[model samples]
Target: MRKRARQESAFLNIPYDRRYESLYLAFIASLCAFGLRPRATIEIPSTKRRLERIIELIQGCRYSFHDLSRVQLDRNSPTTPRFNMPFELGLAVDWALGANPEHGWFVFESRAHRPEKSLSDLNGTDPHVHDGTAHGVLRGLTNALTRKIHDPNLAELDSIYRDLSKAARKIKESRDGSLFEARPFQDLAVLARQLAEERISSLRS
Candidate 1:
């Protein structure tokens, strides 16, 4: 039963910060649009052991997306580069090779060949570059998951993002809070799923 669920879900491993908010939203929207359920550690409550929870998510989801774009140093802190994204990507790669070679994952980057400079061990592997934009992320995601999802094209993905953004704004305005907050994020996922269903229905009609 657990294996089945894992096969049906896709785990999202991206930087959890305001700078990545738009890309994150675009990823979620694109996944939902193509009928894939997106899961992330953010869905877990803060009270739990986060690392353990993240591992659990990685183990439970057959498909994972690791965005290695934000490996650079933070503007506020000149010396300290963020390593969480690559760290989790490493974990996922290890798990796939050790536990299940069939488990598939994609490495995402903002610029071409950037991952090679930061994580040279992944030299032979290719990452989908998003150019640090919402549209780019959507296109990268679509191309990466081409085996599982039909191509929605950039125009269709843009349409979905626009619709989802409008719905997300309504939710934020109604709640008067940050959409990335736990509850609001959950609501946004629900709304994305609803919108995806509506899209499918329209296509069928």
Candidate 2:
């Protein structure tokens, strides 16, 4: 089994397209606020096989957040539906059940029971719905994690979001209005970690 501290890291599986950018940011910020390090495939370099990299991340992290909000048909390709999120969720679930039953996972969808249409196997499981909005993501994430982690209260979560928004705006200004690039994403993660540490310290003091 992995060390307890190492298990605090959370692997995030969500859509990578621009449409989910805000929800992505909210997820990152919410995880940091709960004092968890957020890990994603984005941090991996292009030199490695993507599947291998994702598996490596899942193995390293003790918890995972899987969002199946975009499993519908593609706008340009109506007949084809995206399955990356569900595919990753399956991987994580298998690893947790087989390797470490203690591993944790939270599934999020834009609509309740929608995942059942695409993945009937998950019929009875309740996925937190986020309504495809950033605030909804924040709320759902907070509720999902609070039971497992030492999470902040709802008001504190709101404060963390406010701080994240300010930090993101600063990063965007510094980057000449280009904020989602690799460097900016790294900076945002660093800022979130720092903010989380500060909050914890304040609570302790």
Candidate 3:
């Protein structure tokens, strides 16, 4: 008589430092739904190992879903501090999916083959436009998808864009929206310099 866990609540209730609560919860549900009643009760660490191996394979480009072992649903372990496999595998997946440089296994389909463009393209008449719509869109999409899907490498961008988009949307919905002139080039220049000097120097190694 095991009651089903609410997906969103289960997702949020996992420990803060533990990253892959999203994936683990989903995996547990999937296992239970498949009738593995006895297996789903196991601790996160055991299941985490399998996910880690799969991510490693993905990172090395040598793995597929078929390569992993099926986790039993009814297996329960009394392990505490829960496994961080989901978070770790998520990082590997993020690495596999690329970060600042586009070299990940999972690439976005949105800009697969399109030529990069500037903001002026949308408003050719604006001689002082700094067209950064492309960068903005790409940044937003990458952040949202990666964070929501548990891809770790690109997770920071989520809060960055969440704040950026919130401001942008608020401005857009205002009566003086037309006063929002594009300064994309200036923003890009600042971003480039910030990335090269300030940000790059701060990386973990």
Candidate 4:
């Protein structure tokens, strides 16, 4: 039973394309943002190095549009604040996921209890225009890959994920919010991998 559980958990960490109507929309949106025409499927490498490369490319492109340096945490707030760049990128991811829930390409859990941030919260004194930009970037990147794979359904899933992430960010930013407890997706991936390794080791022991 433990082994099965561990296998399931590990499987979650392995990224795969999803199947949903919104996913296709996300592909189109992403292509538009990246200035690329839609293809049958976005090509992505199956190796870890390739995955990291894709993520890095997205992260690099994401920082070009948003200025995260001035992101301010509410004073007297206990929860650690999300920097602007990461925050914006996160929002993009949620929106992309939300846009298409049917696509199976996105593997992250969009429905989990999230940090309680909403669009209103993030739209503080300054205009949160970059929220859309970040969203666009995510769409663009997802499209770039999905087009190669011939899956258009992931677009909507990416949209939804971005929307949920925004909500989660607002919740996490709040004093009573559990944002601080939230781990970076990369960190969570690492932890999950380690947990799986440990679980496997225990069986052998």
Candidate 5:
């Protein structure tokens, strides 16, 4: 059962900040639209051995999506840039390259040419450019994944995303209005899976 779930899971590697909330929810909805469960490190406790836990999460998922849209420096006092997303992406790369050949990985960016300039390591690879919008994320996902039996329509995907956004907002409101927290994130994922199932079901009917 666990192995089956893992086969259906996708390690969601996106920034969990306020600025990326819409795109965050968009990713959850898009991945779920094609029947892939989205998992993240948020489920892990903020204790020791977090890095190892992240690697474990990546290993459990058959697919991994890395979003490098938060490319600018954060608004902290030190104003340092974030490396966690890219670092985990590296781990996913290592998993696909050396550890598990079945593990699939993808990169996403807001700007069309940013990943090539910012992360030259992915020179030959092309990151799905979302143009920093929820609609773009849906289109990007359509380009990224496909299901032979249940290929999702872009219009239906957008509908799912819109519905998920509404549910996510309510879930966050009940949880101190924080969209990126552990509990709310889990709720959001559950709701997204449900909503995607419904939307896709109607597509077949």
Candidate 6:
């Protein structure tokens, strides 16, 4: 289990709102299609401070995917910029720099050059830009993580994403809350892995 966890699990650090729903599901599908498991704070059991829980979760995974597209100001009251994504990215960065140098973290954006403008610290680093589309997310993941064998194309990812979207709708309709809720999120991850596995199996057969 330890070896499998280190080899397959990936900490997903993305926005958890309706606007970012498509990309969220895309990330799950793409990661699973690439033969990886996706982990998030929602599925992490409650223990101590949320930040600590986040760090612990990151420690468990060998890779992390961060989407910094929603760094702009919030539209609702107070109108403050959302920093959770970047803040968590910082946690992953620190962990990669100090404790676990093997931890791999990838940054993604909706616009081409926005990441550079938003975070000057990452000047030398290139954040994969997905242009806020589901296909874009898949493309970014393909570029970020290579799989010489079992590699998936946009069509395969689109199929998995559509299936996940249908499943997400059913999950939300049957459940009492949003997709961001703990149970709902966990359900999506589980279903994604299953569907992705099925897809890969079919390809092999």
Candidate 5 local lDDT, residue 34: 84
Instruction: Please provide, for model 1 over 1-205, each residue's C-alpha lDDT reduced to its tens digit, 9 standing for 90 to 100.
Output: 9878887678888888767878888988887776667888778887899999989888888789999898877779467888888888888999999988877989999999887789999999989999999989988877887643444667777777888887877776877746666677677777777767666553223
**Error in Å for residue 180 of model 5:** 0.7
Off by over 4 Å in 3: 1-152, 173-175, 178-180, 184-205
Model 2 earns a TM-score of: 0.87
Candidate 2 worst ten-residue window by lDDT: 196-205
TM-score of each: 0.89, 0.87, 0.20, 0.23, 0.94, 0.92
> What is the Cα-based lDDT of residue 32 in candidate 2?
79
Residue range 41-94, candidate 3, lDDT tens digits: 122344367655544333432211110111113235653433343344344445
RMSD versus native structure for model 1: 2.4
lDDT of 2 at 104: 88
The sequence of per-residue lDDT tens digits that candidate 2 reaches over residues 123-203 is 887898989988888888777875444567666666676788788877878988765566777787777767766765532
Each candidate: what lDDT?
Answer: 0.81, 0.79, 0.28, 0.32, 0.87, 0.86
Which ranges of candidate 1 are over 4 A from the true structure? 148-151, 174-177, 201-205
Candidate 4 positional error at 15, Å: 23
lDDT score for residue 139 of model 1: 85
lDDT of 6 by residue, 92-133 (tens): 999999999989999999998887789999898899999999
Give the Å shift of residue 159 in candidate 5.
Answer: 0.8
Q: Give the per-residue Cα lDDT of candidate 2 at 171.
A: 82
In order, what is each prediction's RMSD in angstroms?
A: 2.4, 2.6, 22.7, 17.4, 1.9, 2.0
Ranking by lDDT: 5, 6, 1, 2, 4, 3
Winner on lDDT between 1 and 5 is 5
Sort all candidates by TM-score, best to worst: 5, 6, 1, 2, 4, 3
